[model samples]
Structures are given as C-alpha cells and as structure tokens.
Target chain A: MKIVLSATGPGFEAAVDERFGRCPYFLYIDSETLEIEATDNPGEKASGGAGIVAAQAVADKDVKAVLTGHIGPNAHEVLSKAGIKMFTDVTGKVREAVESFKSGNLKESTGPTVAGHFGKGPRV
Target chain B: MIISIASGKGGTGKTLVATSLALSLSENHRVQLLDCDVEEPNAHIFLKPIFDKRETASIPVPVVDEEKCTHCGECSRVCVYNALAVLKTAVMTFPELCHGCGACAYLCPEKAINEELRGIGVIEIGRSGSVDFVHGVLNVGEAMAPPVIRQVKKHIFSDGISIIDASPGTSCPVIEAVKGSDYCLLVTDPTPFGLNDLALAVEAVRSLQIPCGVIINRSDVNDSQIEAYCDRENIPMLMKIPLDIEIAKLYSRGIPLVLGISEWKDRFIDLFEDICACVKQEAI
Candidate 1:
C-alpha cells in the first residue's frame, strides 16, 4: 500500500510540513518496502480551493493514507470519500512520521483538523 | 443615478448611510434601495420592507453524463477550481468547489457534460412605503457572493435614483455591487485600520473609473489623518457624522439615523444633492 506525507522537501529526511493543502512537497512511500517517491505540491499557489485540489492530487497518486499536521474541511471530505484514511497532527521528519504510523502512534482524524482559509496566503 | 455606499472595513456605517439616504430621497423622487451585502444584509432591519416577492438565485454547474463519459480526465484538467476529479472508471464532481464557469462542459470531448441550475441564494423584493426595497441573502456557508450581488444589481431602476448598500470590503462582492454606479460613497472611520482599508476601497472604485467621495463616520473619535488623506487623494469629503451615543443606541434598536434624529433626514437629502452635483461635475 502507498501512503502520502506532507513534507517540506523531496526526501524522507525532509521535515513534515504542518499544512496539508499548500505544503511544499508530498512524499509517496511504499508501506511494505519503505521506498519513497516525492513530488511538488501542485496546489501550493491556488487562489482558492487549495485543499480540494491538493486532496485530488493525492487521490490521483492512489495513496491509501495521508499523514499531515492539519487537513482543512474540504480536503478532509474529498479524501474520506475516496476511502483514503487521514492521520493528522503529525510532526517530525517524514521518516519518523512513517515509523509512528507503522506503530499506530498517530490518531486517525474523523473530521477536518483545521478551519477554512487556514492555508490562505497573507492577503486573504 | 445609481449610487453605491461601500466601506473597506465593516461597521463603518455603509448601511446606516445607505438606508437613511434612500429614506430621505424617496420623499422627492423615486428611490430604490438594494442591499447587495448578501452575506449578512442588515438594511432590512432598518427599512422594514414588506417583502412580497422572493426569488431564488441560481447558477449553472456542470453535470456529467456518465454513459458517454470516457473518464479521460479532460474535464478535470480544464476545471481551474479542481471541482472535477477523474477516478479510474468515473468522474467525481464537487459542486461546492465549482464556480459555475462552464469551462468543464465546454471542454468536454465526449459531449457528456451538461449544465444544471444550483440555487446559491434568494432575493427579496418589496416596498417600505413609497421607496422600493430589494436585498440578496446568500445561503449559509456559500462562498460565491458575486452571483447573488449581480442579480440584485440587475434590478437597478434607471428612471430614478438607485441607492446600493454594498457589502463592507474591497473584494469581489463589493466590486460587483459598486462597479458601473454613477458614484460611490466610501464611509470610513478616523483610525489607522479604517484609513488603510479606505485607501484600498478608493483604489478599487477609481480603477472602475467611478467618481467617489468620503463620508467620515464617527469623525470626532480620532485625528485629522482621514481628512488629510482625502485632500491628498483629491476625493471630496462629502459629510462628517460625529460619533454620537444616541445614534449608536438608535442603530442598535434597528432605527435609521434619519428617523431617530429627524434632523439627519435633511442632511441626507443634502448629501444626495451633493452626490448629484459631483456626478454632474464629473460629466463636465
């Protein structure tokens, strides 16, 4: 199974970013093999609906789960509807977050972890 | 003439001025008051119009016909809002994310996309005595306000003066209501935040080439910075409504200032005349 982690860079050693919608990068990792594939977050600069767009991008990758610090309501709805479980309030490096997930240390989010416009730019 | 009352910040007395001006002007001419602040319209509280017509405002959202859809992700790729998503076998549409732009339907290669009407808000039309009253109420949690505001602007009366109470902000909704008006009244307080936002609001109105003036609400509460800014910007200081506890108390009770104070009625009438003069001056 593949899992996604919001990251600050394109590597497992990169720190996990707190924002799910406009995070800098998304690290897709193999659950069993621990191999990683990272891609830049495409919704980083969206004017609005960044969360929904980011969730769609992750869904397209066919990830079974996502680990991030916060998930906005719209993204949470889209991901949950796609049957992709979300573990939120995650911290530390991408590798450590994966280990915590393996040991089931992270709590599954039943709803949005943050309010709308949480990932908005300075102007908004 | 269509005049819009706007403010870059909330609680700057846009509705207060708008309602009173409409009331005072109705005595001598045909006046229509449109509350385009769909998110939280408060003009009804003061005007107390007897609404006889309620119309649901809707926008066209794309609906996909799955039978002919190829699931090629064409529609998803074209949607700037990311409202559409393509799974392996089907397309998922998020109606909330859609802006009713019709781009997806237009770009669909399989001819499976069609448009459907989705209600976003409601429009109430009625009369408070001789003055016509109209307002738009956006459904709760609805982010797109421009569509509803546009619907209210469509009801602008051409024969007589139209007074539009725009939502407080310099964003899309305010722009939708204030644009194309004969003049705009930017009501603001005398404070740093008020001045900052007033500048933004002024820029927005000027960009549309609309003549605008300033109304200093609570004018005595602060310094002369607002007046200085107006002079520098070449914007006329049309009026100054001093900070009055009695006025605030009346507003809290849903009474317009012109009705509660009586003297303000004539002042608002004069304000309207000054606006007409400004409009005529701009024409020459």
Candidate 2:
C-alpha cells in the first residue's frame, strides 16, 4: 500500500524530481490514505553508484512501487530484482503524480528510461 | 628524465607532441615513449612498434565467502566506491566500481572476504626504431583506466628519457600519467576551450610540484589570450606549430610531424632542450 516517489523536497506539494537517483528526498505515501513520510535519499551525495544506492534504499524501505521522471539501468536492475514496480516519466508535483497513479493514469515501466550515468551529467 | 606530454583538451596534439619529442630525442639519446592514455591509445598508430611483450593488467577485487559471512555488513559499509551491497540473504559485489584499494577485504572483521585479481587490460611492450615503446589497451566495457595507465608507466627505464603520452582532461587518468614526471608538456590551442582546460591542467600539474611548459598547436588560429596567459603565469612557451594544411594533411595520413617535415625534427629537439632547461632551473 506504500509507494515512493523521487522528489525535490519533503512534501506532497514538492515537485517530482526528474532524476530518480541524486534526488534530494523521497516521499513515501500510503496509497489508500495519501499519508506521506519523506526520507533523504542516500544517493543524493554519493560519489558513484547513485542509481544503485537509491534503488537499494527504496528496496530496503519495502516500497511497492517507484514513480519518477527517469530511471537509469543500474537502478532499473536493482529495482527489478527487488520485485518493485517502476512507473517512470511521471511528471507534475508529488501529490498530482500520486493522484494519477491512484486513478490508474500512470504507465508501468518495462525497462530503464535512460542509459547508465544519465542522472550524473550536467543538468541543463 | 621523465617528460610527460599532456593536454587538458583532447585532439590538441598530446600524442603528436609526445611522439615527435620521443622520435627526435631517440636520434641523440635513448628514449622510451609510453602511451599512458590507455583508453584511446593512438600513439602506437604513429610509432608503429611491433609488440614483442604483452601482459595482462589486473586489479584485486573482493570475493566474499558466503559460508563464513555473518552478514555483519562490514565489507559493504567500508567500501567507498559503493561497489558492494549487502542484503539480508546475500552480499553482492560490483567489481567494475572497485578501485582495487583492498579496503573492503582489509576491513572485513569476519575474514570472509578474499581478494582476486581481475584483468582489466593488456600492456604491450615493443620497440619502434631506437625508441622503446610501451602502451596499454583497456578492455572494452571497463571504465577503470588508471590501473592500465599505471601498468604502462611500470616499463619506464631510469637511464633514458621517458616520454609519457597522457590523455586529455585533468581527471584521474591524466594525473596518473603526469604524476612523478620531471617535466610536463601541456599542449593546447589558442581557443577558449583550450585555455580553460589548460588552466585546469596547469593546476593539476602544479599541485604535484612538477615543472611544466606549454606547446601551442595552431598558434596562428588565436593569439593574445594564450600568449598573455603564458606571460602572466611566467610559464615558458616551449614550442609553437602554426596551422598549416600540409600538417593537417600529413596527420590525416598518419605521418608524424618530424617525419612529414624533416625540419620539424630540430624543432622538437629544441623543445626537448627547453624542457631540460626548465627541469634544471626547477632543481636549482
């Protein structure tokens, strides 16, 4: 019933970050009640393997799904192996994305949305 | 003396200057030219050394013994590279992220981790005319390059002049190649990107306390800025090669500058002597 969305800040109104790894915070929201709890993403300051760190952190939290703008191959693999469903390219703020997911408007990702190290490049 | 040719920006003629200097120096002194770029080592294309010795370059990675592992999470917690992940049921190792520092295995309290050598590349040693040649070819899909660069530098001869051909950028690989050299020749153009990266390369070289000089390729393309930089920094402008269609044509044909235009031989020799002077001045 709990799902995680990569977010720029720690609230339902915070914008959903395009980058799954290196996103500042992850908002954990219970799908039914819409109650939210945010935790700092460990991968935000990691020197390397940001994707792996993020995915492992999510897996450890026992999140049932990940909703974000993009996901790299490493994070994709870790999440896939952990049996967590990924719904990427989900735009809008965290609350909107969760609402869309609840309404079955978001599509599930079958594979990685970007190449490895895609999140680490200059944001422009 | 060990002189390394490095350019902060790619295609600014690090290999060109390195091979020319090595070829010219070989005529008068024993010279060893090491292609330390490892990732895209093209000095061999110009030197054409028939490799007589080839050895695999490897680095040690941790191998966890699951039977003895207490799942204490020590190895994974200690890894700075994020190469290891310890789950409740299993411990995973991503060797590609490993820098081979042996920190994980060294810090494992349960003594469940052992080290194993993983081949990352191959080092080739050969001779091109009188110049001793050495280079490393990193394996495909391998992101690690410093290990292979280190392997190439291992072949440096103490009694002769060793010229290391460093890759572009002031990253770890460039530092690995330029470190511990008597003199570093930073090749660049007169453009903005060239000057920007040149400053970074100079900072890296200066941090190591190594004496360095600049070689401006296509010196006619842009001027006052690069020259002003040299003047302001008090770094000598050792050599200058103008932008010429003939030089470009010859380079396209894989011909060295010294070989394409015999007059350039003495120029490179002068460049070598200038480097020697700088090295001696630094020592004094």
Candidate 3:
C-alpha cells in the first residue's frame, strides 16, 4: 500500500508539515520498498477549497492512506468517499511517521482533524 | 444614475456615504438604496427600513443523475472550482464551492446532470420614507455573496437614482456590486493602507470603464497624500468629511450623520450633484 505524507521539504528526512492542504510538499511513500517521491502541493496557493483540491490530488495518485497533521472537513469527505483511509495528527519526520504507520502507532482519524483553513498563514 | 459607493478597505464609511446620499437625494429626487454588502450588511442599522418584502436568493448547482452517469470525469474536469469529483463508481458534488457557472450540466456527455437551486441568502425590500431600501443578508458560512448582491440589485428602481453600498475590497463581491454603475464613489482615508486599497479599487473601476470619484472620510486625521494621489490620477475628489467624535458617537448609536447633524444633509446633496457632473462629463 502506498501512503501520502504532507511534508515540509522534498525527502523522507524532512519534517512532517502540520498543514495538510497548504503544506509546500508531499511525500508519496511506498510501504513495501520504503521508496519516497516528493511533489509540490498545488493546493497551497488556492484562494479557497484547498483541502478538497489537495484531497483530489492524493486520490488521483491512488494512495491507500494519507498521513498528515490535520485533514479538513471537505478533504475528509472526499478521501472517505474515495475509500482512502486517513491517519491524522501525525508529527515529526516523514521517515518516522511512515515507521509509526507500519507499526500501527499512528492514530487512524475517523473524521477531519482540523477546521477549514487551519494553519493557513498568520492568524489575524 | 446608478452610483456605487465602494471602498478598498473596510470601515472607511462606504455605508455612511451611501445611506446619507440616498437620504439626502430622496428629499427632492426619487432614490433607491441597495446595500450589496451581503456578508455583513449594516446599512439597515442606520436606514432602519421596515422590511416588508423578503425574497430568497439561490444559485443553480449541478445535481448528477447517478443512473445515467458513466463516471467519465468530464464534469469534474470542466469545473474550475473543484466542486465536482468523479470517483470510481460515484460522482460527488460540493455545492458550497460551486459558482453556478452551469458548465458541468451543460457539458455532461451522458446527459445525466441537472441543476437545482441552492439558497444562499435573502433579499429584503422596504421603504425608509421615500427612499426604497433593499439589502441582502447572506447565510452564515456561505462563501458566495455576488449572487445575493445581484438579487438585491434586481429590485433597483430605474426611474430614480440608485446608490449601491458595495462591500470593501477589490474582490469578486465588490466587482459584482460596483460594475455597470454610472459612477463609482470610492471611499478612503489618507493612510497608506487606505491609499493602497484605493488604488486597487480605482484600477478595478477603470477596468470596468466606469467613471469614479473619491470621498475622503476622516480627511483631517491623516496626511493629504490621498488628495495628491487623486490629483495625479485625474480622478475627481468629490467630498471630504472630517473625522468627528460627534459623528462617531452617532454612528455607534446607529444614527446616520445626515440625520443627526441635519446640516450635513445638504452636503450629501452637494456630493450627489458632483457625482452627476462627473458622470455627465464622462458621457460627453
């Protein structure tokens, strides 16, 4: 099974970004071989519905699960309907997060972890 | 004439100018006031129109007929808003994100899409004496305001002057409210933030090819750089209402300055006259 991790940078050593939709990069990690490929998140700069757009991107990659710090309501709905399991409230490095997932140490989120537009820029 | 009172920044007296102008004009001329700031409409707080007519505003969002849908993903591809998603076996529709552009239903090859109206807000119409008052109240959490603003504008009385109270900023809702007006009155202060937003609002108005004038609210509080900018742009500086503690107190009490000060009523009339002159000059 392949899992997508919202990352702060382009490698498995990079820290896991807390922002699911607006995170700068995402790591597509292969569960069996532990290979990692990173891609820029297009939804980072979206004016609205960033979560939904980000969910669509991950769903298109045919990932079985998403590992992120938070998933918004819209994104949760999309990924849930697509039959992709979400593991949220994830922290630390991408490599550690993947290891946690493999050992079932990470929590499987039943619903959205954060509200819409969470961690988007500085707060007013 | 349709005169839109717009501001680049919020709390710069767009409603103050619009309501006072409408009240002043209604003394001698037929006037209609449209509060197009659906997100946080406050014009009724001052105008206090006894709303007698209420109508709901809706947008037509696509509803997929699953029986006929082939899951081709065409509808999802055409939607710019990402409101539609075609999954393995079903199509998901997010009505809140939809702009109601009708591209999804129109381009569905399987002929399985139909539109259903989703209520976004309500338009309330009544009379504040002779001035017809119309305003839109957007449903809480509804991201779309332009649709409700358009619905409020539909009730505009063409035989009289229509003063549109536009929401702040140069975004979609502001554009929807200010576009197609005979003249746009941009409200601003003399601060840097005010100047920057004023420039944006001016550009938006000019891009729409509408004549625009400036109203410097709290003119005495800051430097005169806004005046310099207006002169450089060759846009008329219509009026300057200085910041006054009395005016602020009255506004806090939901009382229009024109109603509280009485003499300022004539000032608003002058403002309207200047707008007419600017519009006439542009016509020529």
Candidate 4:
C-alpha cells in the first residue's frame, strides 16, 4: 500500500506541513517496503482551489491514505468520495507520523479541520 | 459616458463621491448609479431606491450525471480552475472555484456533465429621485463577485451618464467593474497607505489602457506625497475634498454631502464638468 504526506521539506526527517493544499512538498511512501519519494506539490501556488487540485493529484496517484496536519472541506470531500482514509492532526517529523500510522496510532479525521482559504496568509 | 469611481484603499470615500456625483448630475442628465461593490454594497443605504425590479444573478456550474459518467477524468483534466475531481468511482465538483467557463461540460468525454445556473446574488434596479439605481447583493460565503458586478453593469444608461461605484482593491471584481468605462475617477486619500494602494489601482487602470483621474479625499490630513505622485504620473487631480468633520458627520448619517450641504452640490457638478473635459481631451 502507498500513502502520501504533506511535508515542509524533502524527506522523512522533514516536518509535516500544516496546510495540505499549499504545502511545498509531498512525500510518497510505500507502506510495506518503507521506500520514500519526494516531489513538489502541483497545487502549491494555485491562484484558487488549491485543495481541489491537490486532492486530484493525490487521487491520481492511487494512494490508499493521506497523512497531513490539516485538511480543508474541498479536499476532505474529494478524499472522502475517493474512499481514501485521511489521517490528520499530524505533527513532528514525517518519519514519526508514518510510524504512528503503521502502528495504527493515528486517528482518521471525520471531516475538514478548517475553512476554505485558511492557508492564504497575509500578503507581502 | 460611463464613468466608474474606484479606490484601491477601502474607506477612502468612493461611495460618498459616487452618490454625490450621481445625485448632482441627474438634474440635467439621465444619470445611472451602479453599486458594483457587491459584497458590501452601501450606496443603497444612501440612495434608498424604490427597487422596482429584482432578479437573481447566477453563474453556470457543472452537474454530472453519475449514470452516464465513465469516471474517465476528462472533465477534470480540462478544468483549469480545479473545479472538478474525478476519482475511480466518483466525481466531485467545487462550484465556488468554478469560473463558469463551461469547459468541463463541453469536454466531458461521455457527455455526462450538464451546466446548471447557480445563484450567487441578486440584482436590484429602481429609481432614487432623478437617478436610476442598480446594485448587486452577493450571497454570503460566495467568493465570486465578478458575475454579479457584470449583471449590474448591464443596466448602464448608455444614452446618458452612468456612474459606477466599484469595490476597493485591484482584484478581478474591480477589473470587471471598471472595464470599458469612458473615464475612471480614482478616489484616494493623502496617507501613505492610500498612496501605495492608489499606485496599484492606477496600474490596474493603465493596464486596461483606460484614461483615469484622481480625487483626493481628506486632502489635508497627511503629507502631500500623493499629490507629488499624481504630478509625476501626469494624471490629473480632478478635485479635492478637505478633511471636514461636518462631511464625516453627514456620511455617518447616510446623508450625501450634496444633500446635507447645498453648497457642495455645485462642487460635485464642477467635478463632473472636469471629468467631461478630461474625457474630451483623451478623445483628441
């Protein structure tokens, strides 16, 4: 089985990003072999609907689950409809979150944690 | 001629200037006022139109037929706004993100998608004294304002003068309101924040290649750098309104300046004349 984690940096040692839609990096992992691959999130700089595009990209990857710090209603709906279980409120390093997921320590989120456009911070 | 009043900075008195100008000019011209600031439309509070006509404003959003959908992801691939998502067994639509471009339904491989009109707001049209009034009330939680703004602009008095009150900021909705105006009157303040946003508003207008002028509201409150910038840009400073407590008091009471102070009516008329002169010069 494969899973994806929204991360701030490239590897398992990196911290999990609080925003799933606009996270800079995504770490795709094979649950059994523990192999990891990191890539840029395609929806990172979307003008709008970052969650929609991010959800689409994840669904295309055929991932069984998603591990992230937070999820929005749009992304949550897409993930739920895709039948992909979402484990949220994740913190600390990606490796630790993965370990917790593998050990069945993480709780599946029933719904979105925040509102839309919550990831958009103050403009420069 | 169609003239739009805009300000990059909020609370710079765009509505105050718009309402006064529309009221003052209606005596001689068949003037129309469009409150294009759909999200927080306030001109209605001042004009208090009779609202003879009201209709729902909507945009086309896609609705998919699950039975016909093959879950091929074609509609998702064609949507640039990320309004659609196709999973293996299901498809999702985010109507708020949809621009209503109809690309999704047009490109759906199995012809499963159908376009539906989703209500975003309501457009109201009526009479206020001699002026024709139109404004849009955007539904709460709706992110799209351009469609509603466009609906209001459709009521423009083409034979006479049309004065549009646009929303603050240099965003898509502002562009939709200010586009195709014969002239743009940019209301701004003398403060630093005002000047910064005014520059952005100016860029937005210039990008559209529309001729614009500036109106300095509360001109005596701060440094005169905004004047300096206007001079540097060669954009005419059409009028100036000093920081007067009486004017603020009138505005707070929803009384337009021209109505509260009869003496100010001539000033607004003069301002309209100056705008006409500027538009004439640009035509040359």
Candidate 5:
C-alpha cells in the first residue's frame, strides 16, 4: 500500500534511510514496489508555517496517510481535504508510528487538536 | 502633510519623538497621530487615547468545501504562496500561509474554494486630548500586518497634518507605514548599533525617495556617529534629546517628555515648525 507517514520529530527520518533535507516535508517512494513511501512533518520552527509547509509537501508527494503527534487544525484541514488520513497523538518511536499504520491499529483523528492561525511573524 | 517617525532599531524613542511632535502640533493645527507599530504597540500606553470607534481588522483566507473538492490538485498548483495543496486522497488549505490573493479560488476547477474573512487585528480611532489618534493592533500570533497598516493609512485625513509612529526595522511593516508620507523622521541614538540600523533606514527611505530628517535620541550617551552619517548623507539633523535619566523615567511612566518638562515644550514646538517648513519647501 502507498502510505505517507507524517512524523512530528526527527525520529521519523531516523526510521527511514533517505533524508529530504531542508524541504520541511519529506517524500518517500518505494522503488521496487512502486508504492508511495512515508511523509515526515518537521514540527513547527520558531519562524512558523513549518507544519503547514510539511503538510503541503506531503500533499505534493500525493501521500495517503499522515502519522504524527497532535496535528493542528490548519494542517489537519489541508491534509483531510487532500484525502489524506491523519493518525495523530501517537507517541514513542517513529518506527512504531509506521508499524501501527502497517498493522491497521492506528486510529484516525476526528479533527485537529488546535485551530486558528499558526506561523511566525514577518522576519524583519 | 503626513510625517512618519521611524527607527530602524527598536527602543530608540521612535514613539516618544512621534507623540511629542503630534502633541505640539495639535496646539496650533489639526493633527492626527497614527501608531503604526502593529506588534507590541506602546504608543497607546503613552498617548492614552479615549477610543471613540473600534473596528476589527480582517484579511481573506481560503475556505474549501469538501463535497465540491475533487482533489484534482489544481487549486494547490495555482497557489504561488503554497497556501493550498493536494495529497493522494485529499486537498489541504493553510490559512496562515494564505495571502488571500484569491488566485486559488479563481483557478479552482471544482469551485470548492472560497475566500473568507479572517481577523488579523483591530483598528482604533480615539482622542488623545485635542489630537485625533488612530492605530492598528495585530492580534497575537497573526503573521500579517501590512494589511492592517494599510487600513490605518486609509483613515488618514489629507486636510490636516498627521504623524505616523512607524514600526521599528526597515521591513515591510515599516515600508507600509512610511510610504506616501510627506516627510520621514528617522529617529536613532548615537551608538554604533543605532548608526548601523540608521544606515539601513536611510537606504529604505531613500529607495522610497522620501526626504527624511534625523532626530538623535540619547544624544549625550555616545559620540556623534549618527550626526556624522546625517552630515555625509546631507540629511538635516532636526533635533536631539540629551541623555537624561529623568527623561527616561518620565517616558517609562508614560509621560511625553515635552509634557513632563514645560521648559522643553518650546523645543518640540520648534521641531514641528521645522518639519512643516521642510514639507512646505518640498511641495514647491
């Protein structure tokens, strides 16, 4: 199955071998299986919009699922509208998050944890 | 005429100079004081305007309808700001990143996207003694401020003289506030940090082609690098405030130094007259 994993921490990248540096969002594509790989969410930076950008990256990769901790409303809306299912509030290792998704044990988030604007002010 | 008071670096007495000039000018002419520092606005703390009218500042953000969305990804692709996106099974919208340009909605093949008003800040109109005061307050966590600054500028009356307390820094917010002003007062200190940022501000104002004068605050604290910069640039040195702890204390207590010290009122009065003369000469 083509799956997009949205990891909140560096752990998500630790679980995967390939690193999509500086993109905020990572796209993993399985070469042999021809399936979409997992997507990682590089939590919010001090400058804001990291989560939003990460989610957009996932959308750009055409991911099917987002696995992370506490997806905010802004990110959740974008992912859900893109037909991406979110499995949020899952703690522990990034490998576990991917495992839960593979095992069909990860529960879908009803909605984002928080709503409203999230981003840093203009960088002067 | 509209006069903008700006300092490239924060806490350089930009508001102090602006409010003092406005108060002095209000004695003889109809003066409007506009606080354009949307973030961490402190002019209100000093001016203490009695707000007569208040309005919510809003900007457009994209709203998507799931039923109408086909997940074609067209909306996301058309968004130059990356405010919208399409995943394998769904489409996503990031309101914080949206500039509200309505391009995504206009290009949406399914018409699932629509523009909705999002509260970014508030604008207040009030009276501070005889002067009319207008200011913008960007809500906490809102990334956008130039729009709110634009709204505040629209309320400026052309028939009278106005003083805009611009935000610190030579950035977008400062540009929005200083643009279209008849004159800009670049406030600064005598320190190296002050001179560095002042140079940046000079570049910003010069790019806009707005004639500016420099006001050296805490003039006695450091030597005259700011003065030297103005001399080299041929920008007029309008006035200087001596570094006095008493004055600082007065400011910290929310008192305009000109008001706290009756003897210095004439100094501010002269400063306003000088500004008026400069603007009048520029108009010719």
Candidate 6:
C-alpha cells in the first residue's frame, strides 16, 4: 500500500526524520515495499495560491492515502478529486501515525475542522 | 507624492522608518501614513492613533444551503481555490482558503450557493496630532489580506504626501502595498541574508518598473555586502542606521529612534527629499 504522509504542524514533526524546512510537502515510504512519493502543501507557506502547486505535486505522485494533522478544504478538494484518501488527526510521532495506518487504526477525515488559518490567536 | 517603505525580510524596521518619516514630514507638510502590513500590524501600537472612524473589511464567500445541497460535488469542481468540498454527508465551505472569486456560486447548478460577506478584518482611520494614520487589522485566523489592504489604500489622501508601510518579503502582499507608489525605500541590513533578500526585493520592484532606493540598517555590524550590491546595481543607498544598542532597546519598547535622538529627524527629512528629487527626475 502506497501511503503519503503530511509531516508538518503540531505533534508530527518529531516522527519524521527528514528536514527540508521551507518546503510545505513531505513524502514517507514503506521500508519493505520501497514505494515512495510525497509533496508539500505550498498553500501554508506565506500565502497565495501555492496550494495549487502543492496539489499538482501530490497528483503527480499518484499516492493512495494522506496522513497528517490537518488538511484544509482547498487541498482536501484537490486530493479527493485525484482519488486520494485522506486521514487526519494523526497524533504523536510520524512513525506512530504510519504504524496506526498500517494497523488499520486510522480513519478518513471528513474535512478541515477550523478552516484554513494556522497558528494562535491575537496578542491582545 | 507617495513613498513606500518595505523590507524583504520580516523584523527589518519597515514600520520604524515609515512612522518616523511620517512624523518628520508632518511638521512641514500634511502626511498620511498607511500601514499595509495587515497580518501582524504594529504601527497602531506606535502611533496610538485616535481612530475617528472604523469599518469592517469583508469579502464574498460562497455559502451553501445544506438542505438544498445534493452532495453532487459540482460546486467543488470549478473552484480554483479549492474552497468548496463535497463529502459523504455534507458540503463544506472553507472561508480561509476562499479568495471570494465567486466562481463556485456562479457555477452552482442547483442555485443553492449564494455569495455572502465574510469578516476578515477592520480598517481604522485615525489621527495622531498632525499625522493621519490608516491601517487594517486582520481578524485572527483570517487568511485574506489583499482586500483589507485595498481598503487601506482607499483612505489615502490624494493631494498630500503619503508614506506606506509595506509588509515584509517580495510576495504578493508586499507587491500590493508598494505598487503605484512614487518611490520605494527597500530597507535591508549589511548581512549576507539581508543582501540576498534585498536582491530579490530589487528584482520585484524593478519588475514593477518603479524607482527604488536602498536603506541599510545596522550598518556597523556586518560587512559592506549590501553597499556593494547597491553600488554595483547603481541603486543609491539613501540612508544608514548604525548598529546602536540604544536604538535596539528603544525599538523593543515600541519607540521610534528619531523620537529619542532629535538629530536623526533631519536625516529622515533629507531622505524623503532625496526620494522626491529622484521621482521628479524620473518624470523628466
């Protein structure tokens, strides 16, 4: 089974061994199968329509599933259209999330929970 | 006349230069300061403008009636921004990602989708003694800023000199703020990172075909890489702010350096005059 993991956001960065800081997308692979493909979500990087670029990269990989913390509605629509399954709210390390997926514990996400904004609230 | 102060990287004193220049200019001429950094606005903290008027900034987003939505995914098909999604049980609208382009509402065949205003921010017009200040504060978790920036520009005084404090980076937000200005002051430091990003900002402003100058901050800390770049590119180095610990501490406390050192006021006034001279020469 080919799996795509979104490795940014809270509770997932520590599990992922790779660190390409600025790129919005990341790819994780199955060690035994050696199947590899992934993309960064560019939309989260400093605004603009960078999400479309990120979506095109994911579509090119033709991955089967996405595991990550949060998936916005914009990226969600694109991934769905490409027939890619999305799994959200995967906590702890990247390895653990992948393990949960392999064990059939992970479930598909309904959609983005709190829209597209990232980070905390106002200072005052 | 209009002058835009911009930095290619964040925390590089774009607002500092803008506010000080506006204050110095206000003594002799009417000056309006427009803070176009909607995401993390700090000018209001410094200016403390007594807001005379306030208006909500909004943009149209597609709103769907769940009862009428058939989960057919038609609205999601034509959305370039990916703002609409049709799942198993519901059709969702992501307001943050929505650009308010009205494409989804226009393409909906069921007539269930309607355009509605989404509160993204607020535009405030205020006065601080002689200087007029206008800025926008983007609501928390709001992704859109261009519309709010457009609102800021609407308050620009046509006849008086105006200084726009633009957002950092060479991105779309920076471009939107700096566009249509008579001149642009690209603020940068003498470090390697500053030089690299300054080159990128120069390319951005040059592409817009605008006359630009450089202001090197923390001039005494690093080597002369930025100065060398400006010399090589023939872009004049308009002014320099030395590496002073006192200035840094003042900045941390949300105070302009010129307010502490009176002599610095004359330097900014001269810089503004130089920018005006450059623009006048360009017109010929």
Q: TM-score order of candidates, best first? A: 4, 3, 2, 1, 5, 6
DockQ of each: 0.44, 0.46, 0.52, 0.83, 0.32, 0.10
Query: Which segments of candidate 6 are over 4 A away from where they belong?
Result: A1-124, B65-74, B86-91, B107-112, B221-223
Which candidate tops TM-score? 4
> Which segments of model 2 are wrong by more than 4 Å?
A30-35, A64-70, A80-114, A121-124
Candidate 1, A1-124: lDDT as tens digits: 7999999899988999889999989999997899989898877888777887788889889999999999998888778878899999999999899999999899999999899779777522
- Residue-level lDDT of model 1, residues B1-284, one tens digit each, is 99999999899999999999999999999999999999999999999999999999888898889999998888888888888877656677888778899989998989899999999999999999889999999999889999999998888997998999999878999999999899999999998999999999999999999999999998894748998999899999999999989999999999999999999999999998899899999999
True-contact fraction per candidate equals: 0.35, 0.31, 0.38, 0.92, 0.46, 0.04
Off by over 4 Å in 4: A122-124, B221-223
Please state how well chain A of candidate 4 matches the true chain A, as a TM-score.
0.95
Please write out the lDDT profile of model 3 over residues B1-284, one tens digit for every residue. 79999989899999999989998889899999999999999999999899899998999999999999999889988888888888778788999999999999999999999999999999999989888999999999999999999899898876889999999999999999999899999999888999999999999999999999999998895647898898899988888888889999999999998999999998998888888888888889
> Interface RMSD (C-alpha) of each candidate?
1.9, 1.6, 1.3, 0.8, 3.2, 6.2
Q: Which ten residues in a row have the lowest lDDT in candidate 2 chain A?
A: A115-124
Tens-digit per-residue lDDT, B1-284, candidate 5: 89999989888899999888888778888999999999877888888999989998888888889899887878766666667666656566667777777888898888888888988999999999998999999999887889899988888997988899999999999999999988999999888888999999999999998889999999884656777778898989999888999999999899997789877778888987798788788778
Q: In model 5, what lDDT does residue A61 have?
A: 66
Name the runs in model 1 displaced over 4 angstroms.
A1-3, A30-35, A62-91, A96-124, B221-223
Q: Which of candidates 4 and 5 reaches a greater TM-score?
A: 4
Residues forming the 10-long window of minimal summed lDDT in candidate 4 chain B: B219-228
- Give a tens-digit lDDT track for model 4, residues A1-124: 8999999999989999989998999899998899999988877998888898898888888899999988999999988888889999999999999999999999899999999887776423
Best by lDDT: 4
Clashing pairs in 4: none
Question: TM-score for every candidate vs. truth?
Answer: 0.88, 0.89, 0.91, 0.93, 0.78, 0.71
lDDT of 2 by residue, A1-124 (tens): 8999999889988999999988889999999998889999988889998887788788878889999999998788778877899998898889899999999999899999998777775666
Q: Alpha-carbon error at B38 in model 2, in Å?
A: 1.7
Measured with C-alpha atoms, the lDDT of residue B142 in candidate 6 is 74
Residues A27-109 of candidate 3 have per-residue lDDT tens digits of 99998899888998877887677787788888888999999999999889999999999998899999899999999998999
